[model samples]
Target: MLIDSHTNLHGETYAEDLDAVIERAREANVSGMIAICCRLSDFEEVSAIAERYDNIWCTIGAHPHHAKDRPDITPDELVEIARHPKVIGIGETGLDFHYGYSPREEQFRSLRAHVEAARRIDLPLILHTRDADDEMADFLESEMEQGAFRALLHCYTGGSALAKRAAKLGAYFAASGIITFKKAEDVRQVFRNDIPEDRIIIETDCPYLAPVPHRGRRNEPSYLPDVLTGVCETLGWTPDEGEAKTTEAFFRLFSKAERPS
Candidate 1:
């Protein structure tokens, strides 16, 4: 069975037909989904969705885009939200220099808080990075030296240099729909050569980068197989092998997310 390691099920786009979305994902052979909480404000809804579905899990954190609003958000606050068993990870947080939605300083501060919280709780730290590969590499190396923390770089599109460094730190990497793009050779290359086979995982990052064949359409967990197709192609593995390995990697990284019965 396949698992979508990242999904924004709480996004407004899914409000009208969430039940249908879940059913379709099930029909697509998707056994589990981690409904990512991108904004601190959405944790309530994200948590409730995780609670309502036996196969669905959720994470807690503020995206770097909202760093300015909560520049002082602390690990204590993140740990408090993570008290629920459904909360399996510490963030969808990191630097997003591509958008510059928040000052670089605020973004750095926000990421440190998440890093500390994940270290304290021994849960994986969900990360997002864009257009700041060098900075991200530097920060992760420094923070890892301070203390090791499990980390997953979701929708990774950074340079291979960063991928190489992250892999050395034992960070996991998630491949999103972007891998299916015709012009994403660099991203596909990283998957092919840089990341360790066991460290690779899959995600939809829905309401966003829908895989090819479903391009320009609203993304959902059901489209994960399409993304898996890209993974199989890049990794030179058959469908069965791709599913088993990625599903294995997903469970290994997100160990707190109990398998669906």
Candidate 2:
């Protein structure tokens, strides 16, 4: 069995035939998935998808790209939305200097709010960081000082320094299809040499970052095995071993999720 710890199944990209997409994933042995909601407005749709699928879960929060628009979002609001049983995580939130879709200050503020919400509800924070390693690491370290909160740095392609620091703070690192790219040997090296075995997990981040052989095409959960193959090769684990370890890490971090029988 394989679990796609992060996915955007509710995205418009899958609207035409979401059921077919899901069936394909199941056929590929993707036993579970987390449909992430990067915008509060989309949480209802995302949550509905999770509600309809026993093996699927969802999260509620604004992405860094939308932080400026939803700058007033508070921890209380996040906690309220997270109260739903299908809501198993708090965010796909963090700083993203690569796009600057939102101001850095707003992104930082939003991330702090998400951290507080996750701490309050005792759910993992699904983080997204890009081109802001120094500030991102500093923010994480500062938050850790305030209080510990469970978190996973999803689709990580950050600096070695940040990876080491996050590992020290008990943050899990998710490997995405990016690791399968030819130029991403540096990222593979980090997984192989830096991140601890138990700290690793795999995700498709589907409708985006499709692995090779499917590169330049729309990504989906069914393509997760390609990521698993890359991870297994990098960590020197067989497919079954990698699946067991990553699935274990997924449930460990997102403890609210129900394991499939």
Candidate 3:
């Protein structure tokens, strides 16, 4: 089954047609989706959507872009919120040096709290990193040494070195709509060569990186098949093989989510 492993179904993007967007995704054969939360302030909206649907589950924790807004947030607070039945994962958190929307130190502080929460809760840490592969790689390696926690580098676009290192640490990698771009061969290469085959999954990062043929348009979970097609082409797998492999990896990482009967 197809699962959109990362999404931003909350907020203004989906406000007008949230129901239509979800129905379209279901029509596209998407079996489930993990609605990702990037801000504590946005958790109400995020979790509300998850609660509204049987096939949707949500994650908690802040994105690094807003790290400065809540730098001192502790693992206890995250673990507390994560007790909600629909809150099955611990972040869309990690460093995003490209935007520098938040300072590096604040990002580090917030990410550490998320890691600890994931470790404490036994939930997968959903990470987003851009233009700071070395810092992210180093941070993940060091924290993992402190203790083990599951992680998925959602919408991965980093260099191969980080993928290689993180793979050895059992971190999963997500290929997003980015893989369908003309200039994203590097990303596709990581899917095919760097990340362990069993650890590769897929996402739309919707309202953002919509795949090709629909690039530049707003993304939604309904567009995930294009991303899956791109991944299949990259890995030299047929559509059926890609579907089974990526879906398997997704369920494995987001273990708290149950596949619908």
The number of the candidate with the highest lDDT is 1
The weakest ten consecutive residues by lDDT in model 2 span 6-15
lDDT of each: 0.93, 0.92, 0.92
Give the C-alpha lDDT of model 2. Answer: 0.92
Question: Candidate 1, residues 86-196: lDDT per residue as tens digits?
Answer: 999988999999889999999999999999999998999999998889999999999999999999999988888999999999999999999999999999998888999
* TM-score (C-alpha) between model 2 and the true structure: 0.98
**Predicted candidate 2, C-alpha RMSD:** 0.8
Residue-pair clashes per candidate: 0, 0, 0
Show model 3 residue runs off by greater than 4 Å: none
lDDT of 2 by residue, 1-261 (tens): 899989998866888999999999999999999999999999989999999987999999999999998989999999999999999999989989998999989998999999999999999999999898888888899999999999899998987898998899999999999989999999988887778899899999998999987999999999999999989988899899999999999999889888989
Model 1's C-alpha root-mean-square deviation from the true structure amounts to 0.7
**Model 1 lDDT on a 0 to 1 scale:** 0.93
- TM per model? 0.99, 0.98, 0.98
